[model samples]
Target chain A: MAPIRTAIIGLSSTATTSWASAAHLPYLLSARGRAKYQIVALCNSSVESAKRAIEVFKLPPETKAYGNPQDVADDKDIDLVVVSTRVDVHYETALPSVKAGKQVFVEWPLAHDVAHAKELVDAARVAGGRTLVGNQGREAPPIVKVKQLLEQGSIGKVFSSEVRAFGGTVDREALLPGLKYFTDRAIGGNIVTIGVGHLFDQVQYVIGEFQNIQSQLQLQRPNVLLRDPSTKKVVETVKSNVPDLIIIDGTLAASQIATDGANVLFRFRRGQQFPGDPALSWTINGEKGEIRLQAFGGSSLHAGSYGAPVTIEVHDFASDQVQKSEWSWQSWQEELAIVGRSVGVLYDKFAEGEFEGAPSFETALVRHEQLATVLAGWDEK
Target chain B: MAPIRTAIIGLSSTATTSWASAAHLPYLLSARGRAKYQIVALCNSSVESAKRAIEVFKLPPETKAYGNPQDVADDKDIDLVVVSTRVDVHYETALPSVKAGKQVFVEWPLAHDVAHAKELVDAARVAGGRTLVGNQGREAPPIVKVKQLLEQGSIGKVFSSEVRAFGGTVDREALLPGLKYFTDRAIGGNIVTIGVGHLFDQVQYVIGEFQNIQSQLQLQRPNVLLRDPSTKKVVETVKSNVPDLIIIDGTLAASQIATDGANVLFRFRRGQQFPGDPALSWTINGEKGEIRLQAFGGSSLHAGSYGAPVTIEVHDFASDQVQKSEWSWQSWQEELAIVGRSVGVLYDKFAEGEFEGAPSFETALVRHEQLATVLAGWDEK
Candidate 1:
């Protein structure tokens, strides 16, 4: 199958070094016997940053270095645009691409707030462009297994779920010299907007739609110690309005009526500085069984090890027995590698006419709408 | 101090075997140097049950037996009335005693609904009688340790709290026989009104008052199997309307600012026949440190030896260290024994005048009001 010519907006480190280079690029470039994609252009506010990212990520030598999002969006060679930019610029960068009739995959949190997200979703619909926001968790192996188990009645009916994700504070000292906007509440820096936002999307994707939400968002440390990116010295203090901690309780309508109901309790907080622990743990309970995931905060999956093994247990009602399984992902790279493999499978399915008539655009739009609602709550003063 | 003459109303097995013999009688009769109470009478729906309780608990020869609550309340020597009757009879048995100027300690729920509870509180207030409804958890040892830690700034300025308590269905067979009222929603049989009620009381006692609550309550199982008490046979089926699971997201007033806002998430559920595991866990986050308690439920705490341990870890900012503690209570009886020792100390302090004129009754009434508000939400159709 012909490769889907792809372009990327925003030449930040995450774009060049994180998901873009590690997961997206590898999956797009290496899926044998599957529909292929090629990165043909890179865009940034300055051509220099684009050129730097192109060199760092080893894009084709002929790839264009565009100075702005519109320049890349106007290129007819690009069939898909991947937006990995500052959350504040998501709508601005992605809207042009969607309007120009290209498929789009923006990172989690389509916009800083619901209104802008809705605007982007509406534009994609009118332009008839497919959208895929980066809630890559939907492709995770454990989640995929959980979904299959639910479909097969492994856990009779999922009545409730609890998810927790915590990590030490993101090291601001690591960002570029002038990228403080990422830490600003006005630009969406907090557990509610970023962490739980992704979790809710994943859970909703598997179970169903959320009917309502009641949440308590907290700014645990209002004043954060800022440090210089170059010297790593205390620079200044920035006031934070975004919640470092969030707790949400809500219901999800299950597909089957025999299933009692779905209850979700989620908590996310800034990581603790204490030793011997990473920050994330999740548990999902259905009528038949439960699955739990614990991840330590870091770019590495191994960081979450509590000197104990990670295990999954299943209860079989028919046999009246419980079964257990264990597997290890040595690093965050490995975890992302698993997700990347799944994306390849999806792409292969798409090429084999499996999704030729699938409602990819409509399904993605539904996810976008929910993301908007979360942002609306997040942006409340 | 001279012992205050006391009487027990409702001579059930829990009262005759557990409360009367194991807790109240032993404490009242042999609590030397700290014993400030004595049994004066025993009351039940019938003289036969009262006499049988008197025999089983080995009451003093002078202690009288009464079939009517008013008969006990009319006795000038009866200074305190312990209402350990079925929930439906709590108001009937305790109201007259409180109105008759007797201190009353009623078993929990206060009444079937908030309205009845409010009436009891008002009657006690009007008659100048002290009331301590049986939320004995408020006096538990571990809880006391937690409270002392918070008070002493072991973990400074609590900002968030997560609490979960769950268990298999309360033996409907054990509780429903001869108590048709147990199956009625108006009588408050299921999880939310009963189990979470106890949890909320304990939480409020330790934390403070909730400012608002958003909750989802569900009756997961529509029909529950009922068995014959004497024969131990499956004899019937009972319909359940009250929620088997309850989840709430709330904001609480800080112990300091009265409005310093603490975020709270709480969940209580019946043991799922399939997917659910019986468990209880709590975590509290403060400005300086965090404390976590996990694995807190089951018939025999040791019944699920394969489960995780109950752990308490504290991170102290002043010391720049994290400390850990763990203990196992093989049964609920052992857990209650730990509770008894803690309350015994408080009772000793009270008798020694450590809390002289401390307005303990007023503070207790305030807690009762909070419970009332929580129950009012559940009362809504």
Candidate 2:
């Protein structure tokens, strides 16, 4: 099968380095199996930025650069549109692509608000274009193993689940640039919408739907030090209206007629210490056995220092023993080996132009709804 | 120094086997630094049970047996009274000794209700006697190491925490005969009081005070099979009034006067499977590094069965590495080694008859109050 030609919209940090450089370009250039893909175009709000990304990532000389999202979406040769723009632009970028009958893969939050996310979901459904949201953890191998173990009754009927994802502040100046959307409530930039939204998608994707939710959101650090990009000096103070921390407590009602009696306790925080951060830990208890995933990665503040390797601990009751698996990813290749397998499935679906019944977009909207509810509550508080 | 004579107030399953036989007796009898403490008397509600325990544990032939709690409490030769009775009798049996100025070590949930617990705490305070609540996890080595690491700023400023403890049902017949008090609203024997209460004590003891709390409780299993003890036959059905599961999302207000933020997420459930149960999984994320502890023992149903050893994983950013510690009987002994050092100080106090403030009774009552608030909310639901 011919490789699915892809283009990235929104030339952000994740677009320039993380998604385009680390994940998409490499996966597109080297992916094996029936679902090979390639990056053929680059799109950003500015023509100069698009040209820089093309040059920096060494895209093929024939690959085109577009200043507007519609130009890339309207391109006839593009099979997939990857949106790694600011949270506010996700809907604007992906909506055109969905309408153009091209597959869409948007970074987490899917859209800045629930209304926009709902609109994108609706558009994609009507257009019959496949959609994928960047809930990367759900695509990781450890998560796949967890899903398999739950199916095999490794922990019995899962009665409860606890998930936490916490870290210090993101380098806002380096990442956000002219876009202060992360600190702006109007733009839906906050820990709850971005970080928690990403994690909630993985939680529901792995466990099931959350029936009801009661949450507390707090903007822990109101005054953030914004640094000058060139000199790395404190340039100004950015006032953050969005919540830096979010906690939710609720029950997972019986999904598909299986009242497994599960309760969820989740928390996500920012500007907090990253090491020994409990918010990054997760444990799922079932009737047969339990599974735990401990996150111990280093902080980005210290350059590219690696955190602790992800460890999988499984308890087998009948044998009265515990088994463990540990994997190390010192390079992009190793990390890709874990992320590629699952993301590849969605890519294949997108390449075939079969996106009407995809679960990813709906799942992403559910996460956005949860984030909106949390953010709305924060505003009220 | 003369040996501190000890007497048991309840000779039940946990007392006769695990605590008295496996833990206390061997430690008291063979301990190198514990030669000053001797098992002088054994007592239960029934003299027959007391005699059986004495003989089975190979206590001195002159060891007296008593069927009355007051008899054991007032025994002049007894220096320390170990109360391991049902939650109902805890206040009744231990209060007299506490009032008599005898040292006391009572099992968890100091009393059945918050009011009774308060009375005991008040009595112990007025008596000016030393008391120890059997929240042994505080004394566990892994927990001790975590405390040490935190004190050394291993994880930096702790900003958030996630703790999960769940497992399959306890042998309802074997472990819960006295658990009727747990199911009765009047007695406060629900998961909030017993399970979450026990966990809260350990967490608060380690982390500090919880300034406020909000929780959701669920009676997932409304009916349970009541089995006959002797013949192991189905006796009758018992309607459950208390929740088998609980989820709590709250903040432990920064008590350290430090310039940082923190959040805590805790969960407890009954239907969780065993063997591979993440026994007492906890993570504390601070500014410097993250410390994670994964307790590997199964639930109460499968504890100490042929299962994986409980382990603690520590990821110190200062070191840029992860370290793991395993649990074993030897590990328990190492824990005792530290407890033994404290015991040495305790023995000196015993000899001088100079009791330190008995604050545990009050602490237990505070916990009971928290439980009452949770239970009252559960009832309203």
Candidate 3:
């Protein structure tokens, strides 16, 4: 019943731009969040930075500060170890905590690849510790509503689903200076692994798992230009090994909704959404009707960073009518940062012992494996 | 060129429903069409039927009537043969004309199968006669405009394209009385061969051919109930062997527009258009911009029967501007039937010696082979 004492790695205080500062920190600091979670420690690259974050965020003076994952893992007082560092370091930061038998919460893309993710899952299983991966799209308000609609039979047996979306990038032409690492495939934080991965996961959450997949991942833009956000000037140029275009088609495993299994097709391209078009348009065609979800912002629902004014429309064939609705952050959670709203929802669901919205590390591992399958070859059985 | 003395097969006159009556007849009867072609003969199952059609349509008394394809083909005065019969009869009707060394035009699907279509293509090639296949999507004003926009670099270096459209079926639950044959896979006039096949052709015309394709053809609805149009009562139930759902993903072949190649994904389902949503929504993503086309009707641009209120939007990232436009029939062609408009365009292009819009029999043969590839398996390299 006691609050799960938390230690957040990579928590930053210098700027509000980082994911830790923009999303996780805001939610954990909120009044409602404090009732279920208590931030008792801070872990940064250095003890000094951890002290600085504690002081800036105004945490209790008794909160412990640590510089390394080992220090956090060694602490007996912390119940949850949150790995919120750069994607490349996820394995290093979380492996010690998982082995230490502490509940671990890592951001999505659990690691750079499936192999590392599998290791963490294996360790968690052996240690018998609980795990939660930050795949917030499953909890994103719009997606949740769509799942509810499908369950309610607003549409009949789903025959197929299609998604055409724009990958996350405020400026399609160039990356931000510090975010240039997103262009590297090895880092595993690029579009294919993160952007397409999240969308795929959320779609499966709504429909079902893909039975078999065939995908074409293309590095359409090999060279990526990095520009200073404020100056709007090119700061650097990086060779992008990651694919900017992803095309996937497959059959879904049978689910209650699609009893016979459904066909799935997706097209994800790295670019700004067209000026007037939705950044993400997903259509699920069913026997009697259809459900369409359109987001005006880029496809980052998993990261809780999609732009607002999102809509879900249900078209019933028998009546020839369309019901339209929009989703927004809960009024109580609106005080939190925009990108933190869904994370707050995930936390709320976690507190209620619901893993449907905030899935386990094993669930995230399956998605990582699917991504690996996509990258391995065009035909994946 | 004395109006390219022509003979039309299956020119029905009792009802304004058949493709021959709704599309072809009106086009050829128009003033501009009259200047390019003349209907000198009529061919039906028998001379009595052909004579009745001539009388009903008010054809000149001198217009010769023929009982069979052989009779039409043997007439030395006929320089062009237009075969507008049903799918299963296309090969039989068009083969004799091709062998007679007369220019031939056949309704799309050309035949019930790839082998049959190939034979027609081969016969035309060996006989040294000009040939045209009715893939009107290529010439649909909306498609033509989209192609022009792509050529103009309205959307720079293409990265990918996606199409999610509703296949034509006025009633989602049951088929019309005379359309029971549409449920038979062997007939080749079903959703996969006709609906999806036509959409694929138009996309290829706008972008490029699929270098390779992976598709799932599913018979989502097995037993199709046939109903009388007026009564809306089930008259008979037929077992459906054709796939009602089609999902395809592939890479576009290198073209001037898509220099390197682009990813293509399509999802088509047999149903009515979702209310308040575009029946067909297609997006072409490029390096600098994107082009989107939406039709309120069905995905029958190839049959020149897409429901109206179609729009094309070009979004330029640099300017953050969307240029919107709508396509409609030309003023002169407006007097003709709605479905006849695009057919009229094809006729006009053919008269101007332009094969781009009105593709050749060989071109249609390639599409038939692609459909065969989709049906054969999930992977087509």
Q: Against the true structure, what is every candidate's RMSD?
A: 5.0, 7.0, 2.7
User: Which one wins by DockQ: 1 or 2?
Assistant: 1
Alpha-carbon DockQ of candidate 3: 0.58
Candidate 1 lDDT, A2-46, residue by residue in tens: 777778787554344554554466556663522466778888788
Write down the TM-score of model 3's second chain: 0.95
Sort order, TM-score high to low: 3, 1, 2
Question: Candidate 3 clashing pairs?
Answer: none
Residue B330 C-alpha lDDT in model 2: 46
Q: Please, what are the lDDT tens digits per residue for candidate 3 over residues B97-171?
A: 899999998988889998999998889989988888888778788888898888988878788888877865666
Worst 10 residues of 3 chain B by lDDT: B301-310
TM-scores for all predictions: 0.84, 0.71, 0.94
DockQ of each: 0.39, 0.20, 0.58
Candidate 2 residue-pair clash tally: 31
Model 1, DockQ value? Answer: 0.39
